[model samples]
Target: MSPDQIVVTVIGLAAIAFIVWFFWLGKRLGVKVAVNSSGYQEAMVLVKGGYTPDLIIVEKGKPVRLNFLRTESAACSEMVMFPDFNKSAHLPEGETVAVELMPNQPGEYEFQCQMGMLRGKLIVED
Candidate 1:
């Protein structure tokens, strides 16, 4: 092959490698958190409106796991929802369902029940 052609091929390969490496690094550094409502131990986070500790602290640019737990004795605990993330899922009674949230920005994101009675916040810190 010609010298110029070989150099071009090398550059192209380097670019592809760089792109893959960048994505891998981003994933590795991403944050992950898990919140379990109805959790036997961590169950029921009580939040009293504006600015509460219901705001869970998490690392910026990471994947968050929000676990919704429900009990058969409660009516509609399974219909919990989060408007901020545009997510709505009904979990079966006496079960745990996990939602994955990947927030790329550093900000406070609010999540609440469809009824708006239950609320929580995800506080991302850089």
Candidate 2:
């Protein structure tokens, strides 16, 4: 192969590797919900390119309140959905929307944008 062709091939391979690592093999960000004075678990998540701290930890059988602050106006991120909980909320840009759910069982529940482009997980533990 020509030298220029080899360089281009290597760059293309590198870009593909980066995409794989970023979207699949990368380390995920997580946070543990804090119990507020009212006794409900709460977490504040920033919504931009995706949900910041995309993983949340909470106890089973407790109420969880997630405050999502939408910082971007992306159409794909305009709504957040928790299918397992049958809960969803509209996230307006520059506003904080609260989504509440009660996790009755210990398991992992998925939350995602309306288009499923942005995703997160809620882990409930005994």
Candidate 3:
């Protein structure tokens, strides 16, 4: 095998490992999750574009999981926001990546896409 072939193989395996680990850790954490996407006209209104379940409620200690469901061919859904935790993740297109946020205090944590068009709120209650 050539060096290029070996590198490609390694990269492929690494991607698989990352995916496996992502799902495994996600499930193990027992994160409370909600799915969102810009599927139709009504649904798009909630996210203002391509986000769904824009309004979420959870306990202070509980982790909030946003399974960013991207249905478009382009890579429009790039990142998410959790201002309370100061956390953000760059979401890849056509993938369901998860983001976990643990809000210690009871308040509303807001999130939006990079473009600021898509928005959501996490109401953390005590």
Candidate 2 lDDT score relative to the true structure: 0.93
User: Each model's RMSD to truth, in Å?
Assistant: 15.9, 1.1, 14.6
For 75-122, candidate 3 gives per-residue lDDT tens digits of 445677666677877776566666766667888677887666676766
lDDT of 2 at 33: 83
Task: Give, for candidate 2, the lowest lDDT window spanning 10 residues.
Answer: 27-36
Position 116, candidate 2: lDDT: 91
Alpha carbon lDDT of residue 40, candidate 3?
14
| Candidate 2 Cα errors over 4 Å, as ranges | none
Query: lDDT of each prediction vs. the true structure?
Result: 0.58, 0.93, 0.61
Better of 2 and 3 by lDDT: 2
lDDT of 2 by residue, 1-46 (tens): 9999999999999999999999899988679887899889999999
Candidate 3 clash figure, as a count: 0
- On a 0 to 1 TM-score scale, where does candidate 1 land against the true structure? 0.53
lDDT, candidate 2, at 105:
97
Clashing residue pairs in candidate 3 (N, C-alpha, C atoms within 3 angstroms): none
